[model samples]
Target: MEEQTIFHIINNMDKVTNNLIVQWNKVFEEDLGVSHILVLGHLKVHGKSRPSDIAKILGLTPPTLTYLSEKLVQKNLAKRLVDDSDRRIIHLGITDKGIEVVQRANQKGVELRKRLFEQLTKEERKQLLTIYEKLNKSL
Candidate 1:
């Protein structure tokens, strides 16, 4: 609880996150970014969903979701479907290719985490996880 200690913790977290992003980008290799992967992952988990729902779940703006969806559709990773009963209702669904891509991305993510945390001992890793869980609960 000192102010300086809190600032140091915040700064370290930011640095760690930025480094993880860099590593993620290296492993991902595709043209898609993290948001695209998230959308695809959401669709894979939730099946077809409306753009508004996806936006809400992902904490993205409606316009941002629309843009990401457009890119995914263009890349054939996802498709937009109109509800049979309602012309105004549109749903976004992941394609077969999208599933494959998301699987590969997840595998790469696992590899990245393993590489990054390999230096930490099992006890240290457990402690870190516990600390993170505590911090998350507080948040």
Candidate 2:
């Protein structure tokens, strides 16, 4: 690809992500940020996980995960558990309420995508998906 074409793609992707964030915030109007939701989603999928493992999987700093987890615990969405065998190890687990919240957030995300892509024709949408999948595989 030409240098200008690559730059354009990068810039457009950034703008699209920013716009999506704004629109998502407007629609969800939640107190927690996307990162928090992501952590909850991860827990919901993987069951209980160590803090360090969660940080590594999410590509987040330990302190950042700590902060996010603290907020979730405070909100009663998640809880920290001590390992029975190892007193030093702490595990993070999502609560039942957390599962419910993640479910609602996921539904909102689906709704948001439907609304956002409503302007595109079916063929255009399919092409866009194919392109994204190819790009993702490359990465």
Q: Judged by lDDT, which candidate is best? A: 1
lDDT at 22, model 1: 83
Model 2 score (lDDT): 0.92
lDDT of 1 at 36: 93
Error of 1 at 82 (Å): 0.5
Q: Candidate 1 versus the native: TM-score?
A: 0.93
Q: How many residue pairs clash in each candidate at the backbone level? A: 0, 0
Off by over 4 Å in 2: none
TM-score for candidate 2, residues paired by index: 0.93
Each model's TM-score, in the order given? 0.93, 0.93
Judged by TM-score, which candidate is best? 2
